[model samples]
Target: MHNAQPWRFRYHRGSRVFEIRADLERAMPHADPDARGLHIGCGAALLNLRVAAVHEGLHPETLLLPDPADRALVASVGLTGAAAADSGLGALYPAIRQRHSSRFPFDDREIPQPLREALGEAARAEGAALTFPSSWHLDEVLELARESEARNMTDPGGDTDLARWTRLDAASADTTDDGVPYDAFGPRKRGGKSPMRDLAGLREVAGRDAADFERNPQLALLSTPRDHPEDWLRAGQAVERVLLLATLEGLSSSLATQPVEWTDLRWALRDPVSGTGHVQLILRLGYGPEGPGTPRRPASDVLEVLP
Candidate 1:
């Protein structure tokens, strides 16, 4: 989440459809120049809406990149069909609020195999691939994250995106409608091998404590068949699906997007065995304290209904 809601929605009352569009003002020109992150985020929102609709006894049919000419129109979701809702999606309604990008360290204890399989299945159901890499592959991905982070910190222009979205003060955290608050920054990594980013970057928080994160983080990669606007949308939906399921399974998670954000390193992160071309997001999952919920704009602020 950023300092502001990155998407807006137009609800077509007559058709019972919600059309999502990117808010360019919230676009990160440096970090997300292509607006890929924006679309992914909206895609996640789309998935949430679907789950909510299912819980309300409706089926949500979504169309990604609904308008070829209007790139800003990311996706459109319409309620279709009657009851007989998707029980699985309806089950995830509670998770939507519980899930957050936990930056805290997880326990050294491993996640159960059954839970891991469930998460992979959730991703597949949304048309994306999630793979838990071997130890060697995990090492490579983490190294790349560190390198990417170093570059982002050292370069003068790299943090423009972060500067706009992160609120460091307690007052701002309490007042802001969006953006990650200081309380949710977790601890400065004094140690451990987790791939969680320091949203604070070089800025030091006076009382923010530091802690040791898990060395062997449960790392998974979400990927797609091809890299395109629609694929990113699908990847976004897949990400939210996996996250909701993980939340329901009593796990907290965070994203390691640095590796995937950098073009050079992202290519290297492909599964050498499968040679998958599209590596979407790096997911770190395990048992940890769930991150605090970041504030979101009320539906009124982000949504408009037309007769």
Candidate 2:
């Protein structure tokens, strides 16, 4: 929900390499000046590509931020070699298509411990950490998020990126194929109590209904060792890993970058007991209505083949 997808790709036919690049032109200057969200989104795409490659009997090896000179170059995924793909990763292929951000209210259902552990392992596999905070800690995190949202919504020029990417206009929604559609808005909050951000951005959703979200929002913080470009990339990959696994396990997830998008709020989001890692993303997982699929620009629009 960080405005919209601000990334592009280049697939070299000759080298059989697929590359991920952060499109600064589409970046949210106000929301993510450091472009951390940009890298995270690209990293998520890289994960999906790897899973798809494994399902198709190919191996995808990644090189994060390969060229330091070109900072926009997020990663290069080499879809080469006939090495046997990891079956476990292939198992998540279906979830790639099934997973979408769910902002709707979720039932008061507790996620099993084993599933939580498994999700933690998934993040660890990508060199990141996902920790579901305790009850009192959750209240703090949600308050931090609320404060951040209040700031973002009120700050001048804060809505710039959101306005650019939200395809709410009737003509825009029908013609162009990118940005969050109105259907994916997940209804207005209507004073509902949840950590989910209202991505609608002041746009009116006709016939939409608002309800009370889960009071005990199942929230988790995805963090990395340090706050660098590479670390951001790792956190992004871990996000996709955990999200795909959650989808497979019948859990719907939403992201609250409101807290993580800001500096002070993000620092407060870290677990007090263990204050080592840099929090990158705030994930909300629960059982709820699946968000409608938003439009995506075709691969041809973003991908280019090298001679």
Candidate 3:
């Protein structure tokens, strides 16, 4: 996950089909040994592609893991005429560019009920459920995040993925077309109760300031009925859907996967009473400064055309 951007596209012009594949070379072996994160990232990209296609008045019929034998082949979308295009998804096209993972402190502003319901519906549309943790569950989730962050800081192997994908210097931030840049890391957590992962753990940046994050952060847990590659893909789509809707609703958002990264903590993240769904992501949403846009590889670099 560390902004590795582990995905690629192969478009067949004649067929008007887009093949989404996992870029295994960019996979985080240490952080995501099972390649689950890779699939989720690919799934998010797939959702974006669908949104773009719909916005351009095209209908996309998506098939996940179409080739079972080819594990890296995450998804394939067959594009057709606009007769069956989804206008709802097309409306989210503008939010695609506006949405960014906000890492800065969010003020203690509560999201309204109707907007929350709309966001939840967005997730459900993609075959996933988004639940705002109860007060008790929120505490537990925050503790798990703290525990995971501590382990990552002390464990020699934990920092391996973060270091590889984080640009601590201005020069690298300017040159690299991927990875989280120092400017996007936001201010250091001087004091707060928000369960934010310190991406810059033990690494200092020249002018990074410190600020107090919100004492009570508005968090939502994204989950599916089961845990599998297909489910991960659905969760990814659901997550992006929620994010885009939130962005359009004037909310800033960030993702916290630190707790979800640890196996035991991940299990504990599930709801205690129902205890059914498998949590795929921990989302933080509120009003705050939107994170600076990180560099993205050019489409030409990630996409391929075949005659």
Candidate 4:
């Protein structure tokens, strides 16, 4: 999460433009070698900015990966003109604050059809696709998820990124405003894996149960046409958009990127005949009781005021 907010925004009072650029220092080599996560993180922030703009009664237009040489510069968002936020957008605004990654077991009830449609619409508006698989497809994907969990758990550095962000104790001096908090993380169910369980927070995050995790949970996927950094960012913005929509519908969701992060596994997800470029993330969603909120770095910390 920390890797994404590297750019600074400047408002040109006359032109009414907001310029987005990459912040190089926040980039992580080990976790995000190619800057995919970095772009995705920025893309999520960009979506937040767009939502905020609509909330303020304006249309936000974004230009992606504008500069060729300046690879760090991801997107430039400009407000087109004065416009009223739509009712649907207004409906989702409230969920921004309420939306969070829920790792605990969902109620086992399927999400309402209307809500699913709304979520799909949210992705379409942002130039991405959000798909909920059939039971058969879900079973296939779940096996991949299990494989991903096992792979990440076995990888030595996989846990490092998570541990860096997760705060085990509220009063602990190592507390960070970013990363998952212990309270928000559910127990690690034996013989099972949840998209929310990153495995790094196991002992630190209280109430992990191995048994409960073995039960199957609903699964979803986020896909994009290309696999470049720009796509990752766009996918991220869509990610935020869909997640917000889910929260508004009174549902919870978690993300699993391990499988998608690996190169070989990613290509396997694409249909050779259809030639879908790549799968950015695998999501788990359902009508679960909400989980606690994880820490978000303050706007002041992430939002840089340009000189």
TM per candidate: 0.96, 0.94, 0.98, 0.87
- Which lDDT tens digits does candidate 2 get at residues 44-82? 888888888888888888899899999888899897776
Give one digit per residue, the lDDT tens place, for model 3 in 202-223.
8788898999999998999999
Name the regions of candidate 3 deviating beyond 4 angstroms.
83-87
Kindly indicate the candidate among 2 and 3 with the higher TM-score: 3
Name the Cα RMSD for model 1. Answer: 1.4
Model 1 poorest ten-residue lDDT run: 80-89
Worst 10 residues of 2 by lDDT: 79-88
Residue 203 error, candidate 3, Å: 1.5
- Which lDDT tens digits does candidate 1 get at residues 160-254? 66777888899887887888898888999998888868888888877999999998888999999998888988999999999999999888899
Sort all candidates by TM-score, best to worst: 3, 1, 2, 4
Candidate with maximal lDDT = 3
Global fold similarity of model 1 (TM-score): 0.96
Model 3 TM-score, all chains together = 0.98
